[model samples]
Target chain A: MPDSEAAVRKRIRGLLAQLYGGDSFVETVSDGISLRQAGVSSHALVALLVAMEDEFGFEWDDDVRPEALRSIESLAGHVLSLQE
Target chain B: MSGYANLARLDLAYREDRRIRVRDGVELYYETRGEGTPITLLNAFFLPSPSWRVFTEELAGSYRVVGYDLCNHGKSSHVGPEPTWEEHAADLIALLDGLEIESTHLIAASTSTILARDVALRHPDRVRGVVLAGPVFGPRGMRRQRQVQRAWLRTLESHGIAGLYEHMYPEVFSAEMNEAIGTPGFLGFREAFSALSTVDDLVNGLNRAMEDVGDPAVLAGVERPALVVVGDDDFLMGPTAARELAALFPHGRAEIMPKAGHVPFVDDAEGFQAIVRKFFEEVDARA
Candidate 1:
């Protein structure tokens, strides 16, 4: 079964925390804030994509599209889309 | 007097990881594994010490493999002032001294070779051997160098390393080698590299890389054994550049790694490690 949007967003924040080595900055950001505003670079996005692959059990080819990486909500939407 | 040639198997046991503050209050992140004569590895421009994991793990069985992130790069403090190759060389020396390693072999990738060349010449007694993988220290003329740098800087600014990778990988790696992107090893590398903070360092590192093309007259004086290895399909800097570099060293030799890219170590770790093992044994032979 697919995780609810809230659950998916929480997992992403969790992965971001791990990737940033517990920096916690991403977790502190407002839900509506985009990842780029959260200071996640394009390099970090690739890392996050790979981490999501492992955590969510799906493989994504090419890079994560810009729109999908814009905000936490967008990311959760992307994950849900992948599941569907 | 390390009987390097006699070792039939690498132990791959024991490991040490440390963060030491060297000269000028710069903190460096370093890790070591296996045992025997030490071999220090300097990573590529953008990636950090973790990029050396797979390659180092393979060699740790035979010798002590030390991998370190240059200051401002990895777990190391990015809180330092502007950097110079000379200062980077001194940092390497201080870090080695901190590790209690008097002299050891060196394996460097891409722009990291600048400091490797610096320290090797300034303190040759401290470097037992050197292997410069896909070195960019050649005299490629200012215009061409500037052109390449501008393109990369623009790409990095606009799209980041992911975009930069997409734009450059085709030029850097062969089609077959590029296919390794989805491998577990490469995935781990991508994760590690993403932890880094900003792109300013990449620009600085590349700028510093193009600033100094080592003088051939001085490189010829390097008495220690040196090897320049580039991938056969490395369009960026192929065998010609490698041969040119090798010709400058009194004891230097060059080889082209089959079916690889600008960074052959990442493309074919087995072939890269074999080349390094042989060169290391040769370096030990003279000792």
Candidate 2:
């Protein structure tokens, strides 16, 4: 897992970008942007979680709070907490 | 009479979006277009009527295509008996009666195939032909469907509707088909699904079983020309189960569509529409 939150956001952004068709706009999105604004559909949450789990090499405990999935920063925090 | 009276005001010649009350007083949202032989489309349990938007618009150029949301899904009245598809079948027959359709071709996907089959058997003279896609019926098909239905309820309990859709995606559409439709297209479908779905509604709908779940034995009595179609990649109920379903009907035939999954229309729209159009035409010709 990434040691710092910055690295975690970068990784999360890249993964989300891929789900969004790898468009450059997704790459440049600010960390604070809402998931809906970032083109993270409610439908893609599971796919994103799967990708993140595979990329980070950790299994989700099957109980992620919906708020933690609100933004890149929030998701990074969630992932880093789990790493601890 | 009220149901028939409601239909009297609507302009069925072109296009109309409205809910016609069934004999039981439950309203079902429906859209009808075109002017030829009537064909009613029954979507899978998870999908709303608009999932058939593209196909409905195209088919309306020829056949009088009627697409509707089943009770407890989409814009239809959710007050009906949940999971008892005998009511769903009755609602369908009532819809046809309200529309003044004496006989029509029936196209149903997944679990809805059971309802269509029930209608064809009970009202043999009313069905011109039948198309069953990714049918979760028959002896083996029903068994497999029960197992998967349990998984769906559990998935919904832990991960919500998004997880449920994800679990169903692979079983419903192949990788190639998913890529072909693109992310935006798939998202649109999911958005529509999420808009009309809830955990309780889905659980109730998944619990859906009818009087005929174990009764493919009765299908031999159906003399209607039946076409069973399955996506080769459908993990849930593949070609074998589909063929089993077709064999039950006296005039039935089963065919496989390549690079598709459970939801053949979404997976291979062009091929699905082509095969069905041909089958309906053949049935109409023999009439």
Candidate 3:
């Protein structure tokens, strides 16, 4: 991943933390951790995507999978792939 | 009876209570009125089924109107843990099966547009046409989604549900109408908002289901005629989004409600009803 995309990952983690209410769950948002399992509500997922759009200034195309929002790493990879 | 008492009695007389059991034994609150072709009314996320009473009555004058509370909203059975959009669509189809209705037209507002679109796309044989007001579209560049998320997050975090209502009022109604109509209804809204004050589960679940259905591809294959209506002043879903939504469907068109906001039905009921009535009439004629 490019340094810019990696930077986005870190920012998204922080944003998710704020969105999910800064619980202990935020500390464990590893790439493999499922966002749903990590207690990221659907609303948070939307907020995260919205936050990503604002931060990256790019919209997701129709071809993108909704499941990409499953994990932090998965979402980052998807966003980064879009950037590429 | 006094004049006020007579009016109340008349309203009570017109209301016909009905319910249908969907799949998984979820009981849904629904009402049917008027006659002729059927039209199903989908509930807005926050607004319960009864909130559509005025529009349902207006449309019922000429057509058969069916309005129902989705599972866990209003008086509907709350049986699910966390149902997905697909499951919600199943419930709707099951409702139709229970009612023994073959096919019907659909009208939805705000996030409920997702439900209507999903059902119509999956079961074209079961849906005649669709009318979406303040229609929510799939991810269109994520700007609008982000805007919605930010506004909602701010409310949930700082003010809770009460604060959320204040934040949502302007988005749902025009500034002038907010004072004229919304203010007068605040007391009743207070009771409703209070009930929703701690309803985090319902809110989050519904939001998640809506997100699942936000894929634009879902509507790409919808062949039914669609009318996308948006108020000129609706801050939540603007004209651009409405037009984009219309473009997604093969036979879709967009209409603007001048000087109205998110809930145009409340601000200008007659105007909104006229537009919808005309749209359905045209759809029928084309058929």
Candidate 4:
């Protein structure tokens, strides 16, 4: 991963920790953690998305398919792609 | 009885009561009146069927008007731990099934419009027509308004029922209406608001559910004829959102009532009723 991508990922990790309660499992970004495993229910995911939109100054496009949000890696990638 | 007393007696006599059990064993509270073609009325956020008192009375003479309090509101049991929009829709469908209502028209306002749309999308076979008034979809500019509402709800939670009632009066009713309606009726409104204030679980669960609401596209597929009504003075849901919602319906038209606020039914009942009666007549003609 490029230096910028890594930085973005690190920032996301920090946000996840703050929002979902920081823990060792969340810190390890190299090992992917699913939203479910990270204790994010469907309701919490929506809240997190809203918070992220407010925090990052970008709206998460709902036009995209739900499959895009299946895993944490995918969600991170989606966020990163939006940043680009 | 005197003419006024007789009129009051007639009003009191006009009510229908029934019990309906849904698939999940949830018993829905329902009341029906009038004769031809059932017209189901859904209440807005936290308000119950009684909120539709004037609206129901106006239409009950012509149509089989049915109004029911959703679960967690009014006399209905809050048996389910979480009250999602889907659950509300299910309760509506269950009420229909129990009443043996094969098909009917629907009229919903504000938050209840969410369930109305869901029903139209999910159970198209049952919905003959739909009328949505002051539909409250959190569009882009409404963020600040939503924040205000959230803050008000928080105040309700922290300060107890009396405090909530004091704070909610201005927001719930127009100044003119409040003055004209008098204190006793206003106190009744306060009691309703207080009842809603106490249902914290419903509020929290509904807030969470609203966050991930898919999109208007879910409502895009509804083929039934629909009428979208909004008050010109409804600052909460501006005219633009009303237009957008109207466009979503396959067979839909928009009507903006002049000089009316959020609850146009309350502000101008005669005008609102005329619009609804006319729309249902058109739908009936088409059907």
- Models 1 onward score TM values of 0.74, 0.73, 0.68, 0.66
Query: How well is each residue in B196-219 modelled by candidate 3, as lDDT tens digits?
Result: 324564466445644653667667
| Angstrom error at residue A41, model 4 | 44
Candidate 2 lDDT tens digits, A36-63: 5555544465567668878887765434
The digit string of per-residue lDDT tens for model 1 on B1-287 reads 11111111212221445788896568888988899999999876676776576655668898999888887665676764547778788888988999999999999987777677777889999999999887766634234444666687789889886666556656665665556445322333333343443677776766666677556567877778889989888765768777887888888999898777777876667778889999999899889
Instruction: Report, in order, each candidate's fnat.
Output: 0.00, 0.03, 0.00, 0.00
Question: Candidate 4 chain B, which ten residues in sequence have the lowest lDDT sum?
Answer: B3-12
Candidate 4 lDDT at A7 equals: 66
Better of 1 and 3 by DockQ: 1
Clashing pairs in 2: none
Q: After superposition, how far is residue A83 of candidate 1 from its true place, in Å?
A: 11
lDDT of 1 at A49: 71
lDDT of 1 at B77: 68
Number of the candidate with higher lDDT, 1 or 4: 1
TM-score of 2: 0.73
Interface RMSD of each: 11.2, 13.5, 17.5, 20.6
Indicate the docking level reached by candidate 1: incorrect
Chain B: TM-scores of all predictions: 0.85, 0.87, 0.86, 0.83
Of the pair 2 and 4, which is ahead by TM-score?
2
